[model samples]
Target: MKKRNKFKHFLYLILALAMLVYALPLISFKEGWSWASAFGVAWSLFAFLVIGAHLHYLLGVDEEKQKTLERIRAAKLREWQLKWPEDTQRRQENM
Candidate 1:
């Protein structure tokens, strides 16, 4: 899963770069404006938006997993408290 995420990140980076390159013609123009230049710029803008949204989604998923782990840990700690109240109190005092 880590490898897959890394691969996906790199893939998005490469695609964004490629779109940036394609859109470069829109800025550095020796000739007059053309439909292709406009299209390239539009395409690159869309790619930027898509990549931003995808990264945001990935961040949200990670945060959700962290929240889930915290809840699980809290539940286990409560169970341990119920099962061994004195020992748990002693350990907390030691910590």
Candidate 2:
């Protein structure tokens, strides 16, 4: 991951957290605060924001791995290009 992408992801997470914090009081206080409502909010934030974001990040890692593998395979092919074949009349002479 590049520095810029990390910064952007961090900024997005911060913004989301700030928004949730700002809304917590309003949601809980509006209906006079209950344990269930608070729990629901917490669960929703974790499931949707944290888990979802991390899942997306994990998926991106696989994509990056694939690109790296492709590059490595290409390099290996280039390295072996010189020794690819030596097809000549030797096989016909033996037969």
Candidate 3:
């Protein structure tokens, strides 16, 4: 797979692992089976923050990818125009 897709999958795996770890303590704490309330709450909050940050990062990555695609498309159009200037007029006529 592409590097970007691989990185996205890695991020998803990290998020899933984080959620599992966070929930484990919460479950144990709820069952009156653990005395790590303070630590659990702190860890859970930290995990939540990490997930939020990851979401923001993903959004930024998406925007960057879109910009890259737009740049590529524009470059291709320019190249095409240089190759076939008359095609532009034909396209305009078609429109």
**Pairs in steric clash, model 3:** none
lDDT (tens digit, per residue) of candidate 2 on 1-95: 56687677667766666766666665554676599777867765774676458456644776788899999999998867754543335555677
In terms of lDDT, the poorest run of 10 residues in model 3 is 25-34
State the C-alpha lDDT per candidate: 0.75, 0.67, 0.72
Off by over 4 Å in 3: 1-18, 21-35, 61-95
Candidate 1 residue-wise lDDT, 10-89, digit = tens: 68867776767776755644566677666766777788887786677556667788899999999998988788978878
**What are the models' TM-scores?**
0.43, 0.40, 0.39
lDDT of 3: 0.72
Off by over 4 Å in 1: 22-32, 57-95
Give the lowest summed-lDDT range of ten residues in model 2.
82-91
TM-score (C-alpha) between model 2 and the true structure:
0.40
Top model by lDDT, which number?
Answer: 1
Compute the lDDT of residue 50 as modeled in candidate 2.
Answer: 67
